[model samples]
Target: MSNIGVVSSCSCIHPLVHLLRPSIQKKGLHTAARLAAKDYYEVLVLGGGTGGITMSARMKRKVGAGNVAVVEPSETHYYQPIWTLVGAGAKKLATSARPTARVIPRGVEWIKSRVQELNPDKSCVYLENDKKISYKYLIIALGISLHYEKIKGLPEGFNHPHIGSNYSVHTVEKTWRALQDFKEGNAVFTFPNTPVKCAGAPQKIMYLTEAYLRKTGKRSTANIIFNTALGGIFGVQKYAEALLEIIKARDINVNYKRNLVEVRADIQEAVFENLDKPGVTEVYKYDMLHVTPPMGPPAVLLNSPVSDAAGWVDVDKETLQHKKYHNVFGIGDCTNLPTSKTAAAIAAQSGVLDKTISLVMKNKLPTKKYDGYTSCPLVTGYSRVILAEFDYNAQPLETFPIDQSKERLTMYYMKADMMPFLYWNGLLKGYWGGPGPIRKLLHLGLK
Candidate 1:
């Protein structure tokens, strides 16, 4: 079928087609058609990451095969939480990633192309090659984009020695190598000012690095420093208190409101800006630096009208529905939902989003509301983890009946040995829907 016909068939009217020259639209349409395809899906999901794949599977179970389609570019799907363990030299980087083709649920169409544009008014999405796919209902799960180049002189540090970021699967091993090579001087870890996928990840690796250095008898020479852009170590008070105690005992320097703006690879210097005072800057010399780059929604979502001022999907927090469009829903790190962006949170959101979207598709009012549950497994040392689980109110909503603020080996075992299995075999398979049931069972009507 012709590209224009394919796009038009999906009920999408490209704004660029009308705004730009006819020749440009014609050319772009051909590209978009080849990229998107003429197939009309009942539920079209953009980005086949954790939330997208999970939702697609659930929708397929409800509607049947060929009812759902997922648009994603990469063939490899990464287990991002394991990057911390990889940086700590606890797990190999290779072990944390798998081919996307292997994990995408059966009986669903996978469009191996990047989405270039979104047309909510017309209920269609434009693909990179200029094809358009139409959907009766749409789910946005494109996830966040890591902007490493935003920091000046970062390329030099990332491409050179002594500086590494655990955010990517490729450079995660470099973090362990840098930690292993460090003998003395300041080992600096930075948390950017922007919202990150896992808020606790930047510091989790720091604690692990500190513990690794101590185990190797280099603790006396190494000065571990955590430079964060936030006002406190953690947003939650109970967990922050526990972390402060660990910092004092480990002799790690904690510098709050410090944002990394530049890196000087030749001299091993990192420049920082005080967020409170915009123009003021500070430079620290370091032997090793681990950077967490600023992140934001993908460019396609940012440029679309469906996006908020912050460049995230404008959605109602409770319903996960687009602010202006009733047919559109969002999940994962891409939405401007008031919650900590993590896979665990996404797991909880998937259940809520699935129920809400399904009801909306059937012309029924959505009764399900997301509680903004998020979990961060703060790996303090090689064998310990503080499982911080909370809701929007910052109250501890832990699954186990025990206190979760304290560092425990059981939590570490769960993070290391159990959660990965749950993530792969259960969560992705459309079986695991957070710990809602387990929480109720554990409480046993105590309230």
Candidate 2:
């Protein structure tokens, strides 16, 4: 039977919701009996995020829609890249979200369940309640996890005003609130010590805040400071040089090797531990604080055979195929691909992964290689953006013929207006890959 039919008929699909009502628990008992029946699919995509949905759509064309199933528990799918603009009050938070149900490809089975364990050797996954779902081919795209709790007082400190994080769905809008309520004093932004989904996001908000404050005639009163754990502003040298010039011009203070450790929200103080010095910390009084919490691989990947020592899915950087398990593949923020984790990276990786899987199914080798192409639309202001596109070597692999390191209004429109439309229609539908073809066309007869 179709997974949808079972979901509609049985409350077992939502065990937590079923547990809420004693009356439903009685019905859930009988539903558990039916749930015990094992299910299998030709292709099982483990997440419903950008990579998972895109791959599932591609897989549906290769295999039938009914033969593919996705295991995801969320009710809403977010276009997370937009949160920068959303936090800056350039876009509404509502515009960045859509119903997950609406985006799941038609005729594909949506198994609304959280993955508990991945038994790759057994060619199956263990879902919640010990339900087993086997598959011929598996795609692991379970993205990274945000650890606000790792800090001294956060995930709860957010409850207090004068603090917000653009990294989270819950706390994103609070950033706008904090910015608006700012009268004067230190408006501090942070970047975590670990690998983040969008490395450019932390500083992106800082730039927007500077612009916002200037526009509101509060620039002189506000001391805009950025504390980051990274030694450099950006990985790419070309973009970093450009950004440094902007920082000098705008008079934004950037302190390197400083990591946020605590948020005393009540006292309006933020504490940072210098990575260079052990057990040494400094506290700054802030009128408003924007935190970029430490991030890492999801808990499910911990101790799993499919993961590396650091807990990210172990996959080949070129092919995105599992080094050990040929039948398994990975993409996006979940994999240790040595690239900046962004939706643009996923779009490029999806194209390469699609080819890799196709060739593997034919008992052949994958010829295509991913260049680690990722783009970050560094929103410098409400109207300006520096389109930073680069590859594995941190070299600029720009798409347009013009200089991309400089901030431009056209790029801002592309980031704010065009990217979301393409994400929903092109990337999700498996039709739009990266800008490889367009780049080739535009750069014709030129180096």
Pick the lDDT winner. Answer: 2
Tens digits of per-residue lDDT for model 1, 1-447: 000000000000011111222221111111121244446888888887888877877787778746778887786777778778888889987777777777677757778888889999999988866788888899998888888879999865777788878887657888999998888999999999998888888999899999898899999999899999999999899999999999999999999999999999988999999989989999999999999888777878776889998789999998899989999999888899888888888878888988897788789989998888888888899999899888888777787788889999977877876777666666666666677666776799552
Off by over 4 Å in 1: 1-37
Deviation in Å, model 1, residue 328 alpha carbon: 0.6
Query: What is each predicted model's overall lDDT from 0 to 1?
Result: 0.79, 0.82
- Measured on C-alpha atoms, candidate 2 has an lDDT of 0.82
Error of 2 at 323 (Å): 0.4
- Per-residue CA lDDT of model 2 for 1-447, tens digit only, reads 001100100000001111122221111111111222338998999888888988988998899877888888886788888889888899999997887777778767778788899999999999988889999999998988888889997767888998988777788899999999999999999998999877888999999999999999999999999999999999999999999999999999999999999988889899999999978998999998999888888889998999999999999999999999999999888899998888888888889999999999999999999998888888899999898888998899888899999999988888888777777767777876687777787799453
Error (Å) of candidate 1 at residue 13 is: 40
TM-score of each: 0.91, 0.92
